[model samples]
Target: MARVARTCLRSILKIVNSTLGLVGIAMILYGFWMLRVLQRDMESPSFDDFDSTALWFIYTFLSIGVALCLITCLGHISADSSNGICLSCYMVIIFLLLLLETLVAADILLNSDWEKDLPEDPTGRFHDFREFVESNFDFFKWIAMFIILVQGFSILLAMTLRALGPNNGSNYDIDEEYTSATLPLINPHSQTPPYVVGEPRFSIKNDAWNANK
Candidate 1:
């Protein structure tokens, strides 16, 4: 039953890791799309103000996406090879990512008083910012939340599988010491003697004959 549970956990981990890999790819694609959209927006004649903050945000997303994809590959390789070290590293990476995601989510949720601080031009960039805070920001937060949940579950499954240890049976190699130790010892002196016929012989010296001589 324990072995069965381990097997099931391993299978689940594999699926989760594969799904994470796809998520990573999706993140990278989304980052690229965001960059393209930003570039298009920046090329507009009336869009003279270069928002360095927005540019940094896009770059951050791109970097995170790349990191996710790389970590996902590491996870897959570790799982395939059953490498404890690699799995450990992968777990650490996922944990850090989870932490960062949580922080970002919290920051967005906590400092969401942008409406009161809106600039005079409420119909321009300020409006867009408010719209994002209301809609797109929430969307990003939810995505981060999903990623965190998946990563946490993956870590749990990975740890469980690692704890189960290898499934192979006993070693197949011959053990010479054990073989010799188990063998019966032979003692030649312990054998029974052959049956002998009944015979009695006696020898005596006569001292009187020597005296006569």
Candidate 2:
């Protein structure tokens, strides 16, 4: 049971963590890359009027990257150590993150005038970000969907890992969890009370003869 559970849950968790790490690194790199674009555009004079508000997007990207890196680290620690404290903290953070993203995603998809709910952007950086999303709707949409799936999977894995508790150094241990446990016989009156364990192994000659009779 432990081996099977690990094969399904722990292995999937590893994949999710790796995916998160890659996404995080990509975001971090993309943030830097955007900064480069900003610098170049500013220098090119064609974008001299670049709204400083664009910094908002850059900062948000970097912030998300940092957050994801933190999550990935927490996930790794929780999965490897299976410490109660670590797992607890990881679950709380992941759940909060999922909630936040869910809310934002819901707003974006459900609200027709989502932009109106946003604060007025004097620097127009928000407008630019909105425009970017609108222009690359398909790509961003898929990425967001993927992220949601990954987060959901992570939550399930955490719960399952918690239920399973720390591995006892062997997968078969789970299957034998109750092997030595005292079990009551179904026919308690017919069998002796101490017959909780399986009946003593013995020749069944008497039973065979009885069956023949």
Candidate 3:
């Protein structure tokens, strides 16, 4: 039962872990797609009119995607090996990432003027992002919720797997100190006789002071 539970948890963890990588790859492709779309929409496609903020959009998404993919790969390895240290580090990194995402989500939810605080985009690509989000608010909201739930569940699975420890189920382990060649044939304790109390044991005999006595 314990092994089955661990197997189930590990499978779930692997599935969740793979999702992060997929999302990362999607973001990477999305960044390129956004760039292509912007160029296509322009009357005169050129980099001269490209804004630093627009470039930032591409780089930022790509960087995030790479990082997430790396983390996801690590998660898969840790889950497969059931290494305690790897699981611990994975949990901590996931927790920090989750916390950052949560803060961002909360800021978006609570601060309507958040965009005003952002740097201006000369190319006005951020306006497109805002429009996209606003047009599909429900879809984005559900995606955000799903991401949060998966991240939280991943942390939990990491903890559980770490607690379960590695399953060294093979019967190959042996005590190296007691090989067949070094084992004793007789018990060491058997060489010594057990003590008993009796009058003969207490009585002391004396020899006469003669050479042949």
Candidate 4:
């Protein structure tokens, strides 16, 4: 029954790791798409005064995408090898990433006063931007929340698979032999008999008898 559970856990780990790998690939592609958009925006004369902070934010996303791809590869390798060390590291990183994503999603969901800070513009660009963000807020929040949950699930699966191990327990025969070899030998013959402290010796008078004969 335990063996069956381990097998099922391993299968689940493999499937989850593969799915995460695909997600990493998708992130990479999305990052590239964002980069292309950023480039096009930068080439436009109207975007010459684009905020440097926004550009840095785009770079941060790209870095995160690349990091996800690398960690996904680690997870796949760990699953295939049943390497506890790699799985542990993967879990820790995923946990941290999950936390960060959750925080970002929470901030997005809870902060509703940003519109008040927007400067009144005659061009209506800020208004359109605000509308676009408002329209997509729920979608972004839900997606982030979903990803966070998946990451948490992955962490749990990794821990389970790691605990299952790779069937590397010591062989019974080998352990028996090792135990036998390490024991000290005892010799019963080497023990000394108890000695008497003082005892009178008696000798038979065989000589006197022979003289008499």
Candidate 5:
């Protein structure tokens, strides 16, 4: 029963870890797509000069981290110690990546109006810039926030899964634990002091015979 339980647990952990890894990769690619769109729309003359290069680096790192995490999780599920450190490393990377994304999203939302107050670029036309943002604003904001939340939760879950150790594998020493628990109960009075060589002895047999006589 114990062996079966461990096997089931390992399988579940692997599945969940793999799923989250895929999610991380997808988020990175999505961020890249967003950046591509921004690059094309953003002109040097425009007042909207938010740097996205930092975010690109962050997303790229997260993508690589997620790939490594997936491989490590598979190793764990298979009861292999090859990638034991993968999950912990992955969690740290995810937290940093997601936190950065959330901060960028917040900055953009709060400073959207502020950008308009800046001196317009001498070269690029600012025609309908506000309307463009207004049309796609919610879509971008919600997606960014949602991805960050997902990454945060994934990091937490990955850490928990790593701490849980291997659930489905039977390499653990269950027999040792069982024996340790049962050994004390097997002979509770064994530890009590034994009869010494010259201990006091009462002669109840002789006393009973004399009383009868």
Candidate 6:
């Protein structure tokens, strides 16, 4: 019974960790896609343009961080002793990455001066693109912000669930560990109950004693 319980737990942990890892990867990909759009604007050159290569590097770093998180999750699922350390390190790294991304994205949205210093002018095409994004960037910024928030929340929940153990069932009961009255008797034909203690019924040497009594 204990073995089966552990096996089921292992399987659940594996699934949870693996799923979270894949989600992290997906988030990184999403970031890459957004960056591509921003890059496209930069290539044509915009006043609000950013360094596409630098942004690509940031996404690459985030991708690496996500990979680290996946390794930590794998350790947890495998029940390795080092899992705790790995998880702690990756948690901090993930949080920092989120913060970094948020700051960079905010700068891209709120600080036009910072954009002015960027190298989006291979041929001064960036000035034209800036005028275009200046009008539509707000909507895109809100959407990107929402996605980042949701992704972060998902990571937090996954971490909490992983720490608490497997999420097999929503409800758990300690009473189920004990045999209850509702359970069927194992040997109905036995006059003596399994858990009850009573006087000895008979002994070969006490046959005469019983008869006399």
Which candidate tops lDDT? 3
Off by over 4 Å in 5: 1-84, 113-136, 139-142, 167-169, 172-213
Scored by CA lDDT, what does every candidate get? 0.67, 0.77, 0.81, 0.68, 0.56, 0.55
Residue 170's lDDT within candidate 3 is 32
Cα lDDT for residue 88, candidate 1? 82
Model 2 scores worst on lDDT over the 10 consecutive residues at 178-187
By the TM-score metric, which is better: model 2 or model 3? 3
Q: What is the lDDT of residue 50 in candidate 1?
A: 46
Which parts of model 3 have CA positions greater than 4 angstroms off? 38-54, 171-213
- lDDT (C-alpha) at residue 171 in model 1: 38
Off by over 4 Å in 4: 1-4, 44-54, 111-133, 169-213
Q: What is the lDDT of candidate 6?
A: 0.55
Candidate 3 on 1-213: residue-level lDDT in tens? 667778888899999999899999998888788778767767564535654555665677789989899999999999998999999999999999998998887898899888877766656566787799999999998997898888899999999998988876433234444454355545666356687677563233433334346
Error of 1 at 15 (Å): 1.2
Local accuracy of candidate 2 as per-residue lDDT tens digits, 126-193: 56767888999999989988988888888888888887887775756555665434344344565564
Overlapping backbone residue pairs in candidate 1 total 0
Report the lDDT tens digits of candidate 6 across residue range 60-153.
5467647746754644644333244444555565577578777887797698788665643443335544575678989866865664664465
Q: After the best TM-score superposition of candidate 5, give how far the Cα of residue 160 lies from its true spot, in angstroms.
A: 1.4
lDDT for model 3: 0.81
Ranking by lDDT: 3, 2, 4, 1, 5, 6
Clashing pairs in 4: none
Off by over 4 Å in 1: 1-7, 49-54, 112-133, 136-145, 167-213
